[model samples]
Target: MHGANIVLNGCSDRGRLDQRAAELRSAHGVECLGLFANLTEPGEVDECYRQIFARFKRLDVLVNNAGILQDALLGMIPTDMVDRTFRINTFAAIYNLQQASRLMTRNRSGAIVNITSIIGTNGNQGQAVYAASKAALIGLTLSSAKELASRNIRVNAVAPGFIDTDMTRNLPEGKFQERMNSIGMGRIGQPDDIANAILFLASDLSAYITGQVLGVDGGMLI
Candidate 1:
């Protein structure tokens, strides 16, 4: 932990968001704020950042980690599912960057780390839409990095492998084992694994690093 003092989770579900914020406060004694916004809405995203700026006075680091997994094989995939996936994964990141960079550019120094998935780079079976969204995010990172470099803003992304989240936990038994075996380390990643990676990229230690993608996949792709 960077001792950031403030931990915010941007989610539409205020109940769960508040609960997670409370947990952060109770566990680490850190002040966490829950901001509820339909991120797909550009105005809402702008308003959310306004609230953050009002509280924090300035923005330093932003981790665009909000996403969803709507897994239905292409062709049969629901149209709504495709729309939702891109809206949350790709378009929302762009919106957030627009707002975050607006604030960060004022300070002329900040780091933006987007949470892309391994599927983004590797292309999964039932995740074509998800992959495309994340792939677009990667493009966004590179362009934003170049555009904001003059402002001393650094942009990067982390592509996480099969981490043990609720989303990845319910794979059929055979599918689970298949994924487990694919990991060279023979273990699915933990949230901390990805968090540590993000910290490294966001911290001053990586002062010269920008417009890059760090794959925290435990050798899954290899």
Candidate 2:
């Protein structure tokens, strides 16, 4: 908990966001603003940015952590599912970065962390759509980092390896065990493990780092 002012965007569940905001406020004394936006819509994204800037005036760090999984074999994957995956996972980040970078470059300093996946690099059996989207995001992180470096804006990615989030927990038990067994650590990575990596990338500690993907996957790639 860095105790910074936080604006959460693109949430459709206002009640849950509000409850989480209240909890964060009570625990860390941090101000949290929850805003709703259909991230797939460019106009909604612009409106969300307007609200964020109007309220906070400045954005120190942005974490592009929104994504969806439509797991299907490459041949079995539907056209719409692939499009939807990219719509939320890849295009949404591009749109958000367009708005965010304009502000960050104006100030000449900021950090952006994109949440990716190990599947992007290593590939998986039934994750063609998800993997392609994440792979695209990794490309975006690198290209954006170089493009924005002159303005003192840093862009990096965190590739979580089978982290224990809502997405992973819902996997079939047998598949989950197989994945866990493959991990060198022999355990699922907790959410905080990834959060800590993002925190470092977003902080002054990583001032010299840019255009890199830090894997928080309990040695899955190794």
Specify the highest-TM-score model's number.
2
TM-score of 1: 0.93
lDDT of 2 at 156: 99
- Cα error, residue 53 of model 2, in Å, equals 1.3
Error at 173, model 1, angstroms: 0.7
lDDT of 2 by residue, 30-62 (tens): 888887788888999999888888988778888
Error of 1 at 35 (Å): 0.8
TM-score of 2: 0.95
C-alpha RMSD in Å of predicted model 1 compared with the true structure: 1.7
Error of 2 at 138 (Å): 0.7
Q: Show model 1 residue runs off by greater than 4 Å.
A: 26-30
**Highest lDDT: which candidate?**
2
Q: Cα miss at 76, model 1 (Å)? A: 1.2
Which stretch of 10 consecutive residues in model 1 shows the poorest summed lDDT?
1-10
